[model samples]
Target: MQIGHDAIIIGGGFYGAAIAVYLVRQRGLKRVVLIEREPALMTRASYNNQARVHNGYHYPRSFTTAYRSRINLPKFVQEWPTAVKQDFTKLYAIARRNSKVTAKQFERFCRDIGADIRVADPALRGLFEPRLIEKIYVVKEYVFDATKLARLAEQELRQAGVQLIYDTSVTAVSKGVDIPLQVALHNKQGVQELLTSQFVFNCTYSGLNQLSGDFSGVCSGLKQEITEMALMQMPESLCGLGVTVMDGPFFSLMPFPSCGLHTLSHVRYTPHMHWSDQRGIDPYEKLRGYHKETRVDRMVRDAARYMPELLKAEYKESLFEVKTILNKNESDDGRPILFEKHMDLPGCYSVLGGKIDNIYDVLEKLDEVI
Candidate 1:
């Protein structure tokens, strides 16, 4: 049996949901459907991340990414005002040693990107070891509440009349006889169904190539990592502030508004292992087979060298997810969004973005396509 729609989006994460809503509400397309393997939206990479609303300060090495974040930050905040958390102070500290970018260079980069940056207050600066930290700056950045954002997405999708299929997986996709593409779906009950649409969007993050089969070439040059983000209750002194030690194997302690805790992630310790997609390895299967252990002790011990107060953090739990990135950007730590159109399979597209606000870039590209 076959069902037809104008478009079939094979991911219910933020990008897929956003695309579905935009097609119906903005583009005025009537028949749209979003499919997800999970029972709900934003439960995977979207919720397990650091939840940072990047404001150009985190990417001094990548000018294009920093500038794009600077441009999109305000628009995202304005569009989702209530879901953003701006109560805590966001601080970026340059390491006196072992940092790729020095304090001066970081300042210049921020200024170049037009990001709001200023010397942090004396008290906040004093939180770090002066010998280890060369300089600290208070940057205008914000953390998002993914739970709230998921709710907002649900509301918008409902209002736009999007049909949502949860707890279903897309096994394969191919050229359709009548439509532009055909998608084979497997649900929890062991039932198989076929869906056809004029357009098919593979916004499945780590699973971008999973359903493409022979057309996987269009989603090549991808990498996936099993990453962990440790959640902790901050010490009283650090409760109202978010801190990041820059440009090296350092750590970041940021407010996680969803649980009223802080997420601590270390550059060297966060990713357990990573693999390139060129080998056709199944990332989700690898993630499921690997054991997950909390590395908060190592993170705190190393982080305490720069900020002694980190020793007081109480580890609550860890959030594990498959973090995906474009293989080409691994050198400079760049995070430009990946928007690929498949010429072999016309009307099929694959989308991936490093950061949340990068959605604007995807939307811009979609405008030209759809």
Candidate 2:
């Protein structure tokens, strides 16, 4: 079938939006359409993720993929318009712990990329707050508010004339490399067929397997619920400071002023205690409260650490959120898996596994492949 759209992006997250923008803006493709399941785009893995534009330090010392990723991210960030300035991001991943990496190492990594950073002494630990085990250097970068970024993409795409279909789930994808591949999408209409230029980018992080590429990693194995509470006052110091944490397993802090939830930060992964996707098995409940006693235990522990005096202060409202977590990460291979593969079909291509920093570059390559 000669398709209607020149390109149909499978998921409306950063990669998908970036791909759509690239196809239309850079490649001059007029018929671009983005299909999204959520009423608004960027609601899945991309939306819930910490929006740090990593400066390559997260990758390994000599890893080749890490080196390439580091080299590529800056070029991608620079592609954004002045309105999406490099500094638009609010949080930075400051690597400091009395552990594997040190302040000097972080500074060296920063210098390699010309990334701005502040070297600090262990005595000024509060400067890095929460994870202030020792005074260390902080490498800061503007963090993209995932939600805001998603919404921004939607508006920009619409204004630019990219047709966007929301609240529509892609039930089945027909893969091929021909001019237009027929895709089976299921939504309120039940089932329908849409043809697009065979170049399909499956930026769907959650449904990689569904797109025909078999990724060994599992997103459903682990889960997370981020509970955010505002500090009594917005500390002038913690605005953009974030840490991997001195005392916990993979603890991180990111501040968001754009979301208006900037008073404090949110926490993830409280030890072995795990949560679930709460898959539709339980009807009538959009959310699941933690097991009563487990909830109390976590509250008490969180309160004591975040606010020692929380035992006295009256608690306010709290919102519990859930998402899939990938616990099985290989060491120092932190570079997101970005690849272009055409499954058994001839015209369809799927792009998978990329971080925000490398999104533009990924799309550039994706277009070339198509």
Candidate 3:
């Protein structure tokens, strides 16, 4: 049996869920549905990672991404005020050695992007080793509670009247005779179902290009990495502070509000392995087959070199997910959202965004099309 809908959104991550809510609430689309392989929303990439709501400081190298974050930060915080965590002091330290951007350069970049940045207080500065750290700046940034954000998404999606379908996977999407697209779905028990929709949105992050049929060649120049973020109980001195060592092979430790622990990630150690999606490899399958080991020790050892207080952090566990980014971004480390409209497949669109606040970019592009 085939069920028809106005819009069918695949992959129920944060982007997919947000898009579904936008279509139904903002656009007033009634017959909308969101399908997720997992039993709930935001269980994958959305929950994993650093859970930071970027405020432009993180992207000193990429002006566009930094400015974009600056633009979207307030909007995200305003829209999801309940999920935003602003209780901690956020600091960005410039490494004196082997750093790409200098302390002055980072300060100038922050000011250029209109981000609020100030020199860290003497007390906060004492947390880091002065010999290895050149400067520490207090920045206005916030980390989000993924669990709260997930609950908010579910609430908004439900209130917007979106038909939520969980525990089902989309096998393929093909051109339909009656409708614009036909979606083939399968459950864990081998149960299959067909759904037809006027428009289909491919919001799958890592699996953006994995679907067969009309989705082929829709997205290109993509790369996926099996990334890890170690959660740890911060030391007494670092509990209320989030520190990010800048520019090169550095590390960041910030509050992960959801679990009441801090997430520790390093520039050199966070990404275990990466592969190009252009080779037609499924990232999810690669992640499933690969064995993962905890690199929290390496991360802590290296991070503690810059901030000696990190030696006292108690390691809890690690969150691993497939991190996707544009291949061109490897050069400048810029994260611009990818929005593609398939000319071959009418009423079909694909979206890939690296940052959570970049959702506005996706929503803006979506407004242009639909």
TM-scores vs. true structure, each candidate: 0.98, 0.69, 0.98
Shift in Å, residue 353, candidate 1: 1.0
Task: List per-prediction Cα lDDT, in the order shown.
Answer: 0.90, 0.51, 0.90
**Model 3: lowest-lDDT 10 consecutive positions:** 211-220
Report the C-alpha lDDT of model 3 over 205-237, residue by residue, as the tens digit. Answer: 988887876667555588889999999998788
lDDT tens per residue, model 1, 1-370? 6667999999999999889998898778888999999999989888999999998889888899988998899899998999999998899999999999999999888878887788988998889999999999998889999999999999999999999999999888888887878889999999989998898888889888777443555545888899999999999999998988999999998999999999999999999999887435777788888999878889999999999988988999999999999888888888999999989789888999898999999999989998
Clashing pairs in 3: none
Q: What RMSD does each model have against the real structure? A: 1.1, 6.0, 1.1
Q: Residue-wise lDDT of candidate 2 within 1-370, one digit each (tens)? A: 4466777788887778877887888788788888887777776556545555566545534344446556665664565433232432232333334345455555566577565656554534543345533334455444556666776677779877888887776655554444546566667667565555545666665454443222222233333333333322224444334443322222344444335333222333222234443323221122344441223234435434542333343332333333323443334434444454554545455555546766745756766665
Candidate 2 residue 165 C-alpha distance from true site, Å? 0.9
**Relative to the unseen true structure, what is the C-alpha lDDT of residue 346 in candidate 1, on a scale of 0 to 100?**
90
Which is better, 1 or 2, measured by lDDT? 1
- Once superposed on the true structure, which residue ranges of model 1 sit more than 4 Å away at CA? 212-214, 217-219, 278-280
Regions of model 3 farther than 4 Å from truth = 278-280
> Each candidate: how many clashes?
0, 13, 0
